[model samples]
Target chain A: MEATLGIEGGATKTTWVVLDAEGRVQATGRIGPGNVSLLREEELRALLAAIRTETGGQFHSIGAAFAGCHLAAQRERIAGLLRVFWPSAKRVVVAEDAHSAFAGAFGSGEGIVVIAGTGSNVRGYREGRWARAGGWGHILGDPGSAYDLAHIALQRVYDAFDATEGLVPLGESFLERTGQKDLEELFVYIHSDPSKDRIAALAPCVLESAAAGDRFAVDVVLSRCGLLADQVKCVAEKLRFDRPKVALVGGLFEHSEAYALLFEEQVRSRLAVSTVFVSRVPGAVGAARLADEAAEEHPGVEPKPSRILLRESATSLDGALTEERNPRSRFLDRKSVPELVELFLAEERLVEEALRERKEEIAAADRKSSYAVFCLKKK
Target chain B: MEATLGIEGGATKTTWVVLDAEGRVQATGRIGPGNVSLLREEELRALLAAIRTETGGQFHSIGAAFAGCHLAAQRERIAGLLRVFWPSAKRVVVAEDAHSAFAGAFGSGEGIVVIAGTGSNVRGYREGRWARAGGWGHILGDPGSAYDLAHIALQRVYDAFDATEGLVPLGESFLERTGQKDLEELFVYIHSDPSKDRIAALAPCVLESAAAGDRFAVDVVLSRCGLLADQVKCVAEKLRFDRPKVALVGGLFEHSEAYALLFEEQVRSRLAVSTVFVSRVPGAVGAARLADEAAEEHPGVEPKPSRILLRESATSLDGALTEERNPRSRFLDRKSVPELVELFLAEERLVEEALRERKEEIAAADRKSSYAVFCLKKK
Candidate 1:
């Protein structure tokens, strides 16, 4: 009667499934978004409580894959949250949405996974080493996402409104679909809402326009596909794989055969990947499979009690904020010589404190270290 | 008795020259950094006073080109500052540093100017139209600048420290030049100082290593030069030039002949340019030439009095701060149906007020419009 629980949590929705020892589905439930960064603590707790109510019975193991679980700290936080609801579960595994997608596509194997749903990211995993590129969200990169495709179409619309040339059929269709009377209203709608999903919704117009032979739209599609292919090539090079195996996931490829074919053709032309497959398996199933493996590895072992405690300090994610706030050393340029000297002294004191904290480790290493080893290390 | 004055002000230094009606140099003065954005009012006033002391003579016309004179408002502010120092001058012309560089290289003609001093920017001027790219400052862009080159070299050094592979000769050179024994000391030095100029000073090591045929260094140089060439191409495309005329400026080009040649080769390979020149003419001389042209055109006509007053209001720069402070519209996501409706109504009120302000202009345009024009416009 021992079973496993699996969950796939994303920006739009969350899905949970319970499976028996033989992998037969026992129960299933669907709920709202479960992205921890996007949800309040109370909302997350309530969602988990509802899931607990629906599942009804205890499980041998539980696994969850979530969006916004890219950082190690995020994974740890989600693991802590899960342990509260499933205290008796023998094993709990938490991972990024991409990792689950990859596992679902190719179980325990080496491959590249590209997810081009609302956003796009290309990740390659081979023999426990991973390489990734072009997942910098909407503002920074995201070259081949629905949002990117729609953004290109909108840029053309704006251009057509401003200039005499470069008009496309998609501009008219977009206006009609949105009930925007003119470019000015379209501008207002775009600026006022500023939502990624709302923007991505316009991607269909681009595809339709391209299918109907709009040159501008066709160019956008081709160029964006080329850019995605470049991302694949970049990942392959970084991973140094002899022949990459790639799996494509997400809504864009599933819905549009034309886009999928175009993307595949471009990628094949650029990279010598051995295989590329489009997977329809839900990431939740992959989570369940992973739980089964973990359970079999550590059979009948009790879960650790200390796993429930959350790590308090904010980690390396805050490094980006620090860099942003102080981009350059221009502040030092304005300070007088004396002030700069004082600042340097203060910084040196911090270094001294850090050294003091590591004094024991340093002394132990010094006692054990040899001159030959030090020279070898230097070389 | 009538002399024309010209000044070229940059991030590193400022140069001023006094010339007679026949373009003979009367007096010249050089001083420290003159970027108005980087200087306080009192500092700028003192610098101007020092310049006045050096060139102690009346001038009929004065033209000043300054860094940070990107916006029309910035130009106006610089002009106001100039008027305070030279009240009796017939005319005071203030422009961006790039414009002066262009004028210096190609007087009143169409050409692209690429500057790679402390920062990097590509500017194309054709007739009265101007197009620019890649001057997003140190944090965002500035891809081919000295700071950018140094930053790339520093990243490689850190990478080598962390991993066994990817070590290059430039890392040792950089460590030696910075007087840092290890990565920890380098980290402290970089964090404590944080100055663009200090970082940029390391660029010479990259160039030297590149010249010495270090594979990693060569790759960095080639890639960066290619990026700069891309910027040049982008500006040319935006300006829609048939055969671009280009001039290279800035300290990097002046000091590094090998780098200049490599950059030129890359740009020429990618773009069909009619002419490419590396000019040694100072920007101040260009400003002087511009003043000479202005004085000839206006003769003894007095400058407009209203031009002395600086614009007081801070405009769209505040918009960026607002966007950063409230990145998401999740505030709207949390509101109930009635609250959301109230928010929408409030937003509509603001829109209505904007429409009210522009009502007269809209009506004026409406009277001169036709159905055919409207449909054509819509199409």
Candidate 2:
């Protein structure tokens, strides 16, 4: 029988599920990562082949939401790959994992979704106008991600070690958990590894310390959560949703109740949000829903793939001169040398006019300046 | 026949002055720039030769204060070069221009001196102890320098051009003074000529606009002056000088009464300074005074050159581990695996003991957590 297939692919793993027209789950499978941006063309083909083997039954429609598919180019590449794999399928849809998460949380409605797992990002939607803020990768700006939380905890450990007083108990516990002999060894380990997920794995220790009344740990978590809340608020304002519903997605908020509660409280205190809740549906299920909705909306017609290229060439002065709209200099190229001289004289006259208009103000400033008067008298 | 020679060598020009033992100026000469850091070894030798020719009869002593002589190594290099140039001179002194400026203003007493010219730096002297702040070169720090001021003004012009509201009068003045057709052409000009002094030349326009009541210009100058004040305050605190005397040096302060007045007001308002005045004594004259003082103090013996090496090797993880004083990890290398396991177990036991000590606090935190209880109940 005809069925719709949904795939949720990330950096670590891929989940695939098949559902019949009535939304009944017919089959399910799991495999390694299929994030198109991280995979080579051959590796991506291998992943698609593996996925095709699992969801091999007759499929009328398919939707694949993959991690690292934030850019339109990435989404189009994934869609093109799916088209090659399942050419006979009536419709194939590809989107960023955020789109599936948004659909899963609010079902194509107006809201904001914040993902704070290994990395953090915020997406807001209002009547088809989508806006995003604070997804600047791990090195620059992930404020409330697990990696951020763990990194801040490690920084505190170093701070405590360098303080005039000895290490605090919270810092001592971080040392114990990591099997590190001291802060020096911890620095060595951090320098050697520098892996985002490996660093993120230490966030649990920070939460535990905060639960045990470590003031430093609590402050770290609270401040990071505040930053996350600010990201949501910024997206909400950009989308101009007065009281948008916000959904917190990702393992950090889903598994850690203490962190989730703190994050929710911080977000609500800062933003006039309508509702804030943890998303229960997985991204795979959201993909299936989007597929079903796309099939119903298009009714046998396939959607066009994204053609907009996002990346632009680096800026140069010549390019800037040609591109920038400057009304004052617009007629310079058409003018003769004598005309240019006249224009230059006119511009010089404008400066004189501006200065003349401000003569009284300048005189007033001179009169009020006791020091200037004193210096002039000395001269 | 016995005359002391003093030279103030900087990025723009070098000033050489010959003074008698009674502090009367006997001769004065000016030459090209001789900043040791900016010059080749041959170029520096030539500049020294030119100065020696100007003060040919120098017999008692010589002092040279050169720009870019901040480090002890630079000072020693300058002193060695002086010894070669005037071998029979009774004493040869070399110092950073800041030192001579400080001596000029305070007469070898305790005080703080701020030099705000093409670049900015702060020097503090307290009971023979010297301290410094901010002067981390142009790319890193120099926040209150004329280069910094002009650079920020240019940045604001671009910002206004990109902004929807369009350019302010301050930005207009900047564009006019630069003689650029538009912001795009200005960008081209800036990229073509990245000279620090050329960029610093635009600072007068900023000050002029600020005096003419441009709010943006006023803010920029105020903020930069505030940064200069902070540098002074930081140096003063580091040297532990209460109500320190302050000397403002450099051509920026000497030439611009408005900027100098505002800077003094901002500094005094922020710091409990005893006195603030511009140094009327040129750096070359201060160098002459230092030469005379050195001859009197040493009588016949020449001072040994600076021995301090400025550069250190880059930090490595292995170096850090070996250098850090951690008593607990000192004996780990001698322990076997079984002994290490035993040590690990002991550390684990310490964690348990520490947790046991805070058991009541942890229990109280758990009991008081209304959100945690809800989460646990939901689970």
Candidate 3:
């Protein structure tokens, strides 16, 4: 039985599935995360090796979908890994996890995929055209992102600080999670961190509270869900996705059934979404399906990531941290040039610290490169 | 014939008034910007010199309130300049324009003063204590600020780009003001700018559109006014004020009667405000009035800005531009470390460019400092 291996990669969880040449389910497989950027090459290879060991089978072709695998270099790196494990395989396909999720929902068709994990994004496809909304980021506007909810919750806590001595339920959750006694320490803890994952990780805390019937938490969750739904509707409207077959992916949809229900309610209420599914099929299966199609079209000739069926991102995804609102410089628009300089100088410390933390790695690489140069000179 | 020189310095405009020993209106004086951060000492002196020529009289004291004049060092610098001009003055008082604005509105009494200039801030005083809301900054939450209005408009334009070919009224205003043909150029131009004044400068455009009944513009302005109004109410409730006397200040109130009315309406509808008035008397007059009270209490002794009637800010006011949301890094929370480093590196270019633009002045300062060291050594 000729089999095609398929994998769906995401930040929250990753899964794999296999399909026969006739597109029937073949074998179940297990793998680690599919988000390419989150793993080192060695780590990814080790995790991926589990599938080969578990199935003990040769694949005719392998299709892998991983989150953040957008750049050609990233796709090539992932493809190289696939080739290494399945050296005898005639064809391998590597693509974005979003594309795979879309395929999983509506195979070889068009629809919208909205993922509200730690972050949030909405992508719609119709008639070979793509329309995107949200995903600008937490600062610019993540809309329904976990970071966004956390920000509002934090802001609310700070606001309530002057109004009352007691902590609100949301604030209490933050304090309990952070193991801090007071709001001041909580404020410092949150502001001191360089990454948002710590803040975003509290989304479940908020959701759990909401599910437990906290008015504020419930309101925040519902409103945030609406904001996310608005993105889906906006994307659908742009792509003219009438009766859109929408696939909800990522943390918010999977972690809390209540949250998923609320989000679905928000979406169904706002937009005429048809076949709104929680995407039980992992992206790996979708990727395998896509791979099967690609193998049929190319007849075993090697195809670059660009040749994959799903649309390549046309928008500038150079998307960076510089676009983020620095919490320290929130009032910058009100500052004069001299004050602006002072603020910029303070921000420089953080950037320098970011580099300083990577000093040993940078130094080690420099030494290796220098020794390489010495060897070349000796040669 | 003893007199006091009072000046109110603001970003929008600076005004000055004179009062006699008996607190009656005296010979008026003319001066330039009262924003201490915006002017060099020489520039300020030259501008303050206008008052000297215009009034041509000595004074018993001088009370000048300048915007952004908060630091102890900043107050001392301004006081030094005042001493040079008012040689024999028994009293000199330098204060924040907000303090003066509050004083101007209620004299020695208590009330809330809300300023919605290029930036927005609300400060309320009751008894001996003070309460404040908003004015965190554009990124943090300036509430009803021009920057807030402008951000919404720009976001609207970007959202509309995928939906329609025609420019919305707000977009039209942005393009017309920037002298750009389409949204692409406008987007590029905005993203390229180092400062936010370019974006904030478009507030009037949004306001004008709102005034002319542009649906999006009207909804945005009204909603923003409500946000700002909420701040005023928050401050009032914190202090437990009944029939609070609220005074509206800043460019939004002064530039557009339509906007001022809308804001007042929002405030009135939300809270039981006994009175709401646009502050016609500039902050400088209020500073002078406070100076008069100080002279009476201390018997002609010079009081530091700290000793003045208004409460010193208890919160961390070491505000900076780093707190701002960098437009380029809008999606940073979603990025990985490698991508984050890339974003940070790109942001460094902007900071480097900022320093490069001032390189000539920096070099000159370095040369001067080196020469000073050489001269000291020779001595």
- TM-scores across all candidates? 0.47, 0.46, 0.53
| Model 1 regions lying over 4 Å from their true place | A1-110, A115-121, A126-262, A270-379, B12-57, B68-77, B102-114, B118-205, B215-248, B263-281, B295-379
Tell me, per candidate, how large a share of the native contacts it keeps: 0.00, 0.00, 0.00
lDDT of each: 0.63, 0.63, 0.63
Residue-level lDDT of model 3, residues A1-379, one tens digit each, is 4788877777656677766665555555444565666677777888778777775558887877776564565677777777777787767777776666566555656778887777777877787676777554443356667877776666666666544645788888888998987765564465445256787877777887876767778778778888888888888888877898777766576556556656766787788865555543445656776676563332222322222322211000111111222343245435543343233223444535544554454334323433432332232
Candidate 3, position B243, lDDT: 81
**Backbone collisions counted per model:** 2, 0, 29
Error of 3 at B378 (Å): 78
Residue-level lDDT tens digits of model 2 in A111-185: 888898888878887865777765545543568899889877775555344322367777677678889876545
Q: Per-candidate DockQ versus the true complex?
A: 0.02, 0.01, 0.04
Instruction: Locate the minimum summed-lDDT window of 10 residues in model 2 chain B.
Output: B309-318
Per-residue lDDT of candidate 2, residues B272-357 (tens digit): 87656555455676665566555343322222221110000000000111112124334533554334323422344453554455
Q: For each candidate, C-alpha RMSD in Å?
A: 25.0, 28.3, 22.5
| Colliding residue pairs in candidate 1 | A329-B194, A329-B195
User: Which candidate number would show the highest DockQ if scored against the true structure?
Assistant: 3
Clashes of 1: 2
